[model samples]
Target: MNVITDNLGMLGQGLVTTLTIAFIGYACALVVGTVIAIFRVSPIPPLRALGAAWVTVACNIPTLCLMILAAFAAPRAGVPLSLFAAAVTAIVFSASGFVCETVRSGINSVSKGQIEAARALGMPFGLIIGAVVLPQALARTIQPLVNIFISCLIGSSLAAAIGVPELTNVTQQLNLRYAQAVITFLTSGLTYLAIAFLATKLGGLLERRITGREAHA
Candidate 1:
């Protein structure tokens, strides 16, 4: 009530920061994850092993622990990062593991018969993957990737642990100042819900458009 009215600017800034971190993290994760997924599916055994190792390590470690290490230990090891960078880095690293797995699953979902047909037609590996496999695989993966994006958005709140001043952190600060924990936290919670709702709706729309195009093609 009064708490929110009095701190509209603060909440707004926090929301912006949250969105910035989440979007950047998700974008980086998508790229890195795709690369890792390729590696997992590579003809080279070493590349597959490397991708497996990455997924195992990244997925095993907790995201918060990764953030703490990035924020604290990295500086001690002579790789200094601002709080924001550390937060984004941790989010990207953690989210990429899940993204990699999701994409690999999508890759696996591609029709083996189609791959065999392409090979029978003498298509090069790169051409087959680029022209035939990836488009279909990516199309099938839209919903899972969208779910990952939403997870990344929610996970961005963990940045508050390292003083990133995102929505959760701002809510904590306001709560301390105003002593209105319920109202302050509820406001932040509702904001997160609203953003997630919008993201899901947009994702559904995009999925439908892509599906329609695929059907037509």
Candidate 2:
């Protein structure tokens, strides 16, 4: 209690940073992932190859290594990038790979007949995908997407490595300053638990809404 009481302002700031990183990273991931997923399923061979290669390479590299490379290597090579930006980039790229795969799977689950019907209606590829396919794919994929979001939330803790003032970093600093290791760790863990619980509940609500909409559609 004293640990939190003494550092309430700092902890609040850290929480805000964590949320910022998580949300911004996820938003970036959503866009990049959706694009990659489309490319992965495109009829064009080169696009499919490019998308597959991206997913393979990004998925193979660990998020921490990506963050390190973005933060350290890119700067050394004349690209000026901040640690916070680099950390978020790492989260985006890594999480986007998983999101790409998940979205692709959802797209694949769409019935071939529906796609053929859309084509028969003289729909362009983009309209078919956007209007006839993406909605259904996303509806079917809400749970997996939410799961990925939860993973991204947990991964934001790695921002501490880049000196980002996110939750884990602040907790570690506070613990060092106060020498209350047990209390500090417990508080941090509980905070994370609360965030995770909220994410799960939110995911459930989203899933229900999407499912209902799809059913009506």
Candidate 3:
């Protein structure tokens, strides 16, 4: 209790950093992933190739290495970003590939009859995608999106490596400074678990809303 009380402020600060990284990463991933997924299904061979290459290469790379590269290598090469910014870039870049795959899978999961019907109705490709396909895909992908978010939340811990002072980093500092190793680590773990669980519940609600809308449409 003493240790928790003493480190409450620091924990609050760390929580803010964690939320910042996750939200930023999620927004970037959503956009980039959707674009790449569209490209992956493009009629143009080159577009498909480019999308596949990005996903393949990024998915193969380790998240920590990517974060370090974003923080250190890019800077040394004169494209400098602060630790926080680098973390945002790293998480987004890495997570985007996964999101792309998820989006693609969802797109594929939809029935061909709907797309064919849309095309027969003279809907443009963009309209078909935006109006008919995307809505359905988003409905199907909500649960997976939530799962990806939970993973992103955990991966944000790597931000500590770049001196971002996210949850794990702050906990490490508290552990060393207060010599309450067990308490600090346990508290951090519980907090992370709690957030993940809460997110899962919220995601379920979102999934219901999205799917209900799709059914009505």
Candidate 4:
């Protein structure tokens, strides 16, 4: 209690920063993942190859290495970016690989018959995918998508490695100043638990809502 009370402000600020980075990173992931997923499923050979290569390389690379490259190496290459932006960009790109696979799985889960039926009606590829396929795919994939979001949320703590001053970084600094490892770590752990619990609840609620909407449609 004493440790928490003493550092409540710093903790709150860190929490805000964490949430901000997570949301922005996740948003970027969603867009990039959707595009890559589309490419993976496209009839074009080059598009599919590009998508596959991206996911394979991005997923194989460690997030820490990505962060280091984004923060340090990029600057040496004349593409300088701030630490916070670089960290978020690395997280976005890394997380998008998983997200792309998740979305592609969802796209595959849609019945082939429906897609064929759409094509028989003279529907353009874009319209068939966008209007007929994607909605059901997204509805079916909500839980997995939410799970990815949560993973990305937790992974944002890695920003501490790049001096982003997010939750884990702030907690580490506080631990150093207080010299009370048990109290500091316990408090930080509880904070993460609470955040994760809330994310799970929210994800469940969203899944239910999307399912219900699909049923009505």
Best by the lDDT measure? 1
Candidate 2: global Cα-lDDT? 0.91
Total clashes for model 3: 0
TM-score of every prediction relative to native: 0.96, 0.96, 0.95, 0.95
* Model 1 lowest lDDT segment of ten: 125-134
Model 4: ten consecutive residues of lowest lDDT: 143-152
Clashing pairs in model 4, backbone N/Cα/C closer than 3 A: none
| TM-score for predicted model 2 compared with the true structure | 0.96
What does the lDDT come to for candidate 3? 0.89
What C-alpha lDDT do the candidate models reach, one value each?
A: 0.92, 0.91, 0.89, 0.87
RMSD of 4: 1.3
- What local lDDT score does residue 173 receive in model 4, on the 0 to 100 scale? 95
lDDT winner between 1 and 3, please give it: 1
lDDT of 2 by residue, 1-217 (tens): 7998989899999989999999999989989999999999998999999999999987999888999999999999999889999989999999999999999999999999999999999999889899988888888888889888888888999989889999999999998998898888788889888988888898889999877876897
lDDT of 1 by residue, 100-140 (tens): 99988988999999999999999987788778887888788
Candidate 3 lDDT by residue in tens digits, 1-217: 7988977998999999998899899889989989999899887899999999999976788888999999899989999899998998888988899999999998998889999999999998888888987777877898888888887899899998879999999999988888898988999999889999999999999888877876897
Q: How do the residues 1-217 of candidate 4 rate in per-residue lDDT, one tens digit apiece? A: 6877988999999989988888999899988988899899999999999999999987899888898899999999999999998888988899899989988988999999999999999999889889988878777777788777787778888889999999889989988887877887788778777877887888889888977876897
* Model 2, C-alpha of 95: deviation from truth (Å): 0.5
| Residue 114, model 4: Cα distance from true site in angstroms | 1.2
